[model samples]
Target chain A: MDTPLREPTYLILTALAREPMHGYAIIGEVAALSDGRLSLRPGTLYGALDRLTDAGLVELDREETVDGRLRRYYRLSPSGASILAAETERLRRNVEAATARLRARKAQALTPRTAGGLA
Target chain B: MNELERRYRRLLRAYPPDYRRERGDEIIGTYLDVAGPDRRWPSLAEAADLGRGGLRQRLRAAGATDLIPGVRLAGLLALTTAAFLAGFWVFAEQQLPPAEAGVPVFGPFVSVGIVAWCGWLIAALVVAVAPGRPARVAIGVALLMTAAVPAVSVLAGVPRPPLLVLAPMVALGVLALAVDDGLPVLARVLPVTAATVGGFLSYAMGVGAYWGAYRGGGGEFQPPIGTVLLLVVLLLAIGLGMRRDARGGWAAMALLTPVGLLNVHLLAGAVDGLASGAPRPTYPTMVGVALAVALLGPALLPAAVALRRRLGTPSAAAPCPTCGRHR
Candidate 1:
């Protein structure tokens, strides 16, 4: 499975990692997770959904009646979960490296001005 | 339900033809079901948004190969340009050194030049509508001849006038001959009205200045040659401006005629030992201004007629470089 995914795709996969839901429900979940930082236009949403479907990481699970309208539910496949895990691991490694560097820089700043070091 | 379906149907039009062919009805049905009574009639803003999107999609689907429609549009534009130019030329010609003035023999040549140009424009339109290898070749050849023929005629001492005058004259005449191309009439109307208004304003200014000088006991004013030339140029520019097919910014520049000429006159008058201020409106000066205005008035018809033809047809938008598609 391809481990790297676009941020939006990763978020969508993360949302579906819990349970299958329709397009609108998934949009709401993603918005909730992002604290309303992201909003999707219908065209963009559908276009992205189409591309994701072709990638096989996401699949249409079922059709449901929502407010008396037909809605297709989507779910992340097992391969999607593995890809999400890999992305998380990659993020974790970057964070660890950055944190270590920040701690070393902090210690160095605290060491006060020394004539020998300046020279 | 009906209104919602209609709205959805309208929205579905934004899709390409192939997409519409496959899923138009389904998409509308789906949208109707989703929207239900909650949304009801679409808002005016939404409708406009949908229309713009749909038009873009339709254009994209139509692709760049639809030269036929554009050619038809161009034909109409050609007619409008021709009509406007012709009217402007006729109206402006009266200001030219009258044949009786014995300035030169460029007078008769101007009229003939206009007629011949009109003939070429008519031929171009016929060819545009009935385009093919032969028609294309004919149009190309005609355009070449139209460009070259006048130069030859002039060089051979056939009395061809300068292109500054000939350009507008030919444009208007050609538009007239191609009037059948079905360009929108308003394209010519708006510009003519604008140009007319501008010309009238300049004339009015000239007259008012004359009246002021006449009353002020100022020195006798003589209309400068540049002023006369500027007036003539503006009259023709007005005709050009009247057409939608005319270049943008052209109409605005036409209004600047008086300002331009005044600037030239202001400098030249001082250099030539005249007063350092503006030209005073004396009897002879008023007469010159009035005469120039009157002479230009007759060209309105030919200008309108030519502008009408050109405006009826417009050109295609610039082509996209990457896609080789017209916008």
Candidate 2:
């Protein structure tokens, strides 16, 4: 089985799922997605991008010059999309399990207790 | 260029030149985009991250990712082996009877051996609790002390440890310095502790057997069952540990090389004694037979792993869809 995607890699793929985005845009999107809990520096982001590209999970979509500076856009490959979907399903199941357990505990707490047992 | 741009470029020099040429502009653009208008310098955390990233890229470029883990495991195993051997030597010497009247109890060679053994013991302790740099320094000092044993023995014209024993100890000391910084403290401590205990027990049994033979007027000493069992258990553990991946296989090979060499030496001695019509050197013969398992054992696992991987991979005869070349 494939290993689960790390949060940064997952968020980067999610950002590119909407449209191919440049490095800075993906960084901003990832930060916003995580509610500002993660702010990827240029080096870290490029490192992850390099690894993903080598793994055939990400590809260079285009390159452009903005205000005399180069910007390279990256997009998720088909394999990356399928892997991300599987990871999302795994996380959703975990969340559902936790939520169900917490709901049951809350319901039990709210019930009126008899002398020796739950009412 | 502005101050921030110049500094960021300087930091980018940490990367390989080819990588810098390819992605320098894009990386610099991202940094500039993230920087505020008033910012003049790169943050410390950013510099550290870039440095780490650059090192990772260099390692990847060198194809060292697979070997580094193996080398690290070799280091841990080597440290354990050295400590075990040193403990064995010290405990065995302690088992020797006191010198007769008007004779020195410990020879110069034995004294030097004890010092070297103590150095290895201290090094094992320091490596368990200390961080990388200090652990490396400790291993270095212990290696130097171990080398001094043969040197001092040769100069003083005293009986010294065989090269088969000293060479492995020295090699292990050097390998131990290759330990990775990321390994937990407990992982480093457990093996050394276990080996030290095993060493003491083996030597105690061997020396006890030697004394028993002398007392019974036996012509030759019998090899201790405990020591033979210890070696067997060590080889078994290494073999079992190697069933996982090529990394484990590589580690097993590194750790076993010394043991294999010693086995070869023992086998040669046994063969020579038989050829010369000497009373069959029972100890070397027995030990040689027991340790012979290590000689060709470690190589098999890695070879199998490689073969399996080769069989599972697609044939190179297939043409690449994009480039129209063999993949």
Candidate 3:
């Protein structure tokens, strides 16, 4: 259960958690979901897919021919879902920490006056 | 289908053989669907990039990050083989003379047999581990060294022990084959063996003459002195290279150990011959030795380091995965 959550792996796991999708579809969805922040180069995409598939966090749901081209659809396995939940919790904690730091900075900035009157 | 298939196959070449056999077609099929028929021929750069990608895939499949570690491992194995062979030869020689009442049966046989064994081993190792360019250089050096052994013996009035040089050359050939990464072991070994034999024959013929009948061209082949000198110098250069590198440990010694031994055989015979008042100062022998040391010493000396780096490095081609070999 060492979290194998590299950026691409995390993104892929997040995408597969939604519904089953083929390789290309997953590529498109990930790009769209990340608003172009994440692009799936073929090499990078396949590598991530292979790892996820191996870890049992993703499973090939079915095979299909769209426009007479073969593609296998992948869905989040139960393990995948659990891992995603853990990742989400981890991310949430990071956000909370950041928020607290920001609030403390704001409070310091808003103080009426400091001893040096630099507030 | 034709365009796609060709491109797919081309890309597939990057993957390791096992991976390609397992899923190359399937991966290509899926790619075709995604890109559709509209996808034009990949530009040269695109193809190159795809090839790199394919390499990465193969690397992942191989469960290894780089080939450097493998090369290091290969060098170690080679060193071990050299040590084992050298030790056995020495032990056999030491034990045989003492035990035998008259003629030492085991010592000569073992020595000769070992040289042949070493040649085959070095040849095999070179072909297996070394690429085309290095393979050629290695084999050439080996053949030259082989001839040098006998030439030195003849000039210095040592016993005509063919096996002394032959065994080490054979060992080196096998060593070469054992480390080959790409070429078939057979391909590397055959050329090396043939070249070694050719060199040996030429040396035997040249030195076997007493500078009387075969003086054709008045001077070109007059004494066969040049060839003899060349072999001696070559042997000396290789010997020096091996010794220098031997300081680096097994890899260095593996290459140097045979040459060192051959030098021993040559020097020992020379010393004995000189002590027994073999001959007066022959111009040819002096000239040959002088020219050999002159031509070979400087040229081979500089290259000694490079040869060591090529043969001595743990893995010369690939960087270490976790940290670069340099780091």
Report the TM-score of chain B alone for all candidates.
Answer: 0.28, 0.56, 0.26
Judging by TM-score against the true structure, name the best candidate: 2
Q: Distance from true position, residue B11, model 2, in Å?
A: 16
Candidate 3 lDDT over B39-72, as tens digits, reads 7665565465457667555544443322322323
Lowest summed lDDT across 10 adjacent residues in model 1 chain B is found at B214-223
Clashing pairs in 2: none
Per-residue C-alpha lDDT of model 1 across residues A1-119, encoded as one tens digit per residue: 33456667778888989998666667678788888876543334444554466456677687656544556677887776777888988988999999999999999999878678856
- Measured against the true two-chain complex, the DockQ scores of the candidates, in the order shown, are 0.02, 0.32, 0.06
TM-score of chain A of each: 0.84, 0.94, 0.89
Give the local distance difference test score of model 2: 0.66
lDDT of 1 by residue, B195-310 (tens): 34434543544442232232222123212322443454456446645763342223223222222222332433344444445543334454443344334433543354345445
Name the best candidate (by DockQ).
Answer: 2
- Model 2, range B154-195, lDDT digits (tens) per residue? 787554544445655676677688777656778778546955
User: How much does each candidate deviate from the true structure in C-alpha RMSD?
Assistant: 22.9, 10.0, 21.6
DockQ of 1: 0.02
